[model samples]
Target: MKLTFPIVIAGLLAVFSSCAKIEHKKIDDPAYLRVFNNLNYTVSIENKDEEQPFLAMLIDPETDTSGMPVSAAIVGDFLDQRDGYAPPYPSHVGSSNSFKNPEYPGKESVLVGPVLNGFDLSSWAQIPSGKHRVMFMFRPVNNTPFFQLEERLKKKVLIDTVLQLDSHEVYTLHILQKNFRTKKNGMVLRQEVFHKMPLSDSMIYVNFYNMSADGFADADISLKKRIPQSGLLMFGVKDVMNVWFSLFTNDELRNPVPGYRFRYMTSLRQNNTSNVVQPYYSFPLFAANGTDGIRTTAWQRISLMVPGMNPENNPYNDQAPAEVLGNYAVISCYGNGTKPGFERDILTVPNMIVNIHSGTNNPQSFATVNTIEIVNGRAYLTTIQRKYPTPIY
Candidate 1:
């Protein structure tokens, strides 16, 4: 009897050890990828039936013996239709609580990555390093998940291409409109430099991309009236915009720091024909240490000025010429928080102001790189959080 009991115990131990070996193993030397749906469209009198911009990304779809897609890996499911970056502040008072509620979760709420700690890599997906067959399908802007949706609804494939990705590299795929007039769309794969830039303590790095649709004419009649030239010379060259920045005291619109002139930024090429990885432009993060004697907060406004405008004077002042006033494509500034408010109000709940020192042992302060994506005449802003010891929430 004692011998039989010892043999049974030995068999049980072996079976349990085998079960532990069935755990999920991490992928070896994976590539990271993130997708952004930047495609913009408008419904007007000319074309009343315009397709919405919602999408579902499928990578290496699995098929049955009959060649039907039985199942596949879904990288991005119902990527919410966003014209620009997600808002920085909570759109409404209680909207921030929705992300915590299990019953009502948000899109891209749970991201698949190598690790969720140490950086804001929640938007990235970890895939095998090699050639990947990617497909972006049109999806309805409804509450249903991608897999739960009807098979017929997922038939429309907008972008189907094979991408060769290298190990340990990061890439951002953008779905953009080829031309606003033609309503054609295409994708641009941008390799992101994830490494931190060599910058001073009070500086942030930024770069610009001119992804504005081709043949996009400014429809602002008031701007045309101010310029007032045959063929509207200003409208003829609307694709080009000069970037400008100004520092001001808290809510002090009437007065700005004296002698702070706009610098000449590199002219971005039209239609995203410029280099995929543009050179970074460094800007000082003005300290709010009350040295200026106005308040403990300083605000910086970035304006996109049209070509031909003189950079010698302040464009916001009334004393400036009408042509200068009308030439601005868009102007943006930092806002309250990362969670955008309900309704996504651009004016009130604008771009987030991330504290570069948030996740570190250093004192908390606002310092972050503002990623400004200009689409058509509007500018969408999103701040990149600096890496620190602690993970970014």
Candidate 2:
């Protein structure tokens, strides 16, 4: 019996060897840095997954849009005319700033600097009559080490190109609304950003559907920007109401109180240089299932952009002057705790349709109309404007 026990134990050990827990070693590297030039004209920074970190240096290229060179800061240091930041980094010079965001943990950091300074203006001196160039630098701070700091840092620099003035003064945007009706009688309205702007500097406008009539209220559209990538515009609407609004901006995320229940965002890509001519589309980049609070009912319809439309390859394809890309995005919430359906993928479409059912309390429906337009450093967001066709008794 003793001999048999020993054999049994040996066999068991061998069997579990592969199942043993594995631990990965931590990576160590001195604090590295990179720069993301919002060559697209908008300020945005992207990480490995292409996911945007909370750290962003929001700036409007139009603020210093000129063929002249100038000196500026990077993040921790300031520079007038140099290749890059000093020390550790070679061929770079500028000022740098660092900070963390309490809202997002461990991953909050930023480094901002000049892109094209007065020293770099030598190239633009005798060029075409209406040529302009603007540049910027970005360096991110992190808790852990990232890969390829040197290469990433250099690519982080952004450069933007613009014409002298009166570039593609297009001023037409589309507005659409989405309404949801759930079993609990829940209602929600969504706004979308449709059409593209050729100019890096422009304003956006959004109007409430029921402000003038009864049951009308207002919400402010929050403007947030991701340097170099893109920006987002969002607003919320509840119950049944009609509201009217008119707003404008030369800076996207800089707009103040554009509309009631609407928030606006812009991408750094707006300031990038590209040979392609088309407006980019705006669709929900992120959405929640609503399992925690204000659960939305199944079969509810919400505003969403229709998919398959190439926001970067469509509008201004054949136009003379370069073109700007534009698109729309919508978000909605429901209550009374209802089962979520396939709405999780609604943001992927260029146009979104969501339906909500709460069961037996209050059945509600809502919708939104959105548009995008650009003129030099000015942008506008305006909806088609709507009033309830019938009473909501």
Candidate 3:
């Protein structure tokens, strides 16, 4: 009886092997991408392909103007919460947790949401890889998408472009909030190849953000160290990257120059205007015990903040970002305010603090960088301006 049972099991194994040999297994290895909404407002995006386009919102802003679709960050926060990853980002207002972004992790499965809200911090969207004609449009907080892209872009702000992607590689199309200059030309959405930050403590990279509301065309931006020129990212914001620093520095000068200091100056000139350009601000590039908390190299970011749509924001919030060194940053306007005595040995110096307020009216501080650290990455959040610079031409 045991021998007979063994023979039957062997025969069953042979049948399974035969079936396995005949069956064909297929594998798909497409490219990958992720969208990050860094603009201070809600945004809807879509892949404009002829055959099968990728759309973020189920409701079309063009067709349904008021169907305010949630943003990538909002969606990401919700998904993470549902997957047992969070209590949910603060903005989640639905009641279902069965949601999944069909474009990633798996095919297009529906998402069940729950009601909650969050700061929408670090929310990112993963998408199928491919070449795409991406259309990025702005939707107000209520999700009321009210304009045909072609018509809306004429009077409003949007970005349209084509991009190629590869398998397993993650890409980011970060949106920055700049002014809408429809009469100028087609402005592509603020995009960047997001490299995962290196884990090393001494790692350094520059994220130059331009949230200036100068009401001018895209300008030629550059960074200079008291020398000759040139220059992350956001919609109206742009970053001049590719700068690196040693995890550590030598106390003594490496070259023979008698004196020693590394300082920087930034220049911005409107692309549509005359060649008359000016230096924004200048500051020391490094500080003692810098990487720990200094501004120049430690912060890893240099932002240009100019007041935009929010008129009240001008000069006050727009003047300088409230940061680690606000006491120094907000006052150093080359003319106005005193440079208080502080232990410079402990803090890093900022390079881009500037008087973006009307140079004509605030000439004393105009074309001058503020001494305070202007919060560069964010769009909103500032104290009411108790006073404004004199209006200039």
Order candidates by lDDT, high to low. 1, 3, 2
Residue 178's lDDT within candidate 2 is 14
Model 2 misplaced regions, further than 4 Å: 1-131, 141-155, 163-393
TM-scores of the models, in the order given: 0.70, 0.21, 0.31
lDDT of 2 by residue, 1-393 (tens): 356987988989988986775553332211112221111113244213232222222122223244322332222211111111111111121113333321110122232111121111111111112233323333344532222235444234322333231222111111111111110111111212222323111121222222111111122121212211111112212222111111212112223222321322222222111223333333221122332232222211223122333433334334322111222322222221221242231111111112223343233222223332221112222222112233334
Q: Scored by Cα lDDT, where does model 1 land?
A: 0.53
Q: 1-393 in candidate 3: lDDT tens per residue? A: 357888999999999887773332232443333333322222223212211111233211222354333223212211110111111122223333444222222222223211112111122233344655554443322222323234432222245456665654443333332443322222222222323322222221222223333342233222101101011121123222111122113222232111212222242222221212222222233333423232221111222323122222324332322221211111111111222243121223322222224435342211111212111222211110112344556
Candidate 2, which ten residues in sequence have the lowest lDDT sum?
A: 118-127
Model 3 regions more than 4 Å off: 1-124, 137-140, 143-162, 176-200, 211-262, 265-393
User: Each candidate's root-mean-square deviation in Å?
Assistant: 9.3, 23.2, 19.8
Clashes per prediction? 13, 150, 50
What tens-digit string does per-residue lDDT give for candidate 1 at 107-151?
343323443222354445567789888877777777676677887
For all candidates in order, the CA lDDT equals 0.53, 0.23, 0.26
CA lDDT, candidate 2, residue 114: 17
Candidate with top lDDT is 1
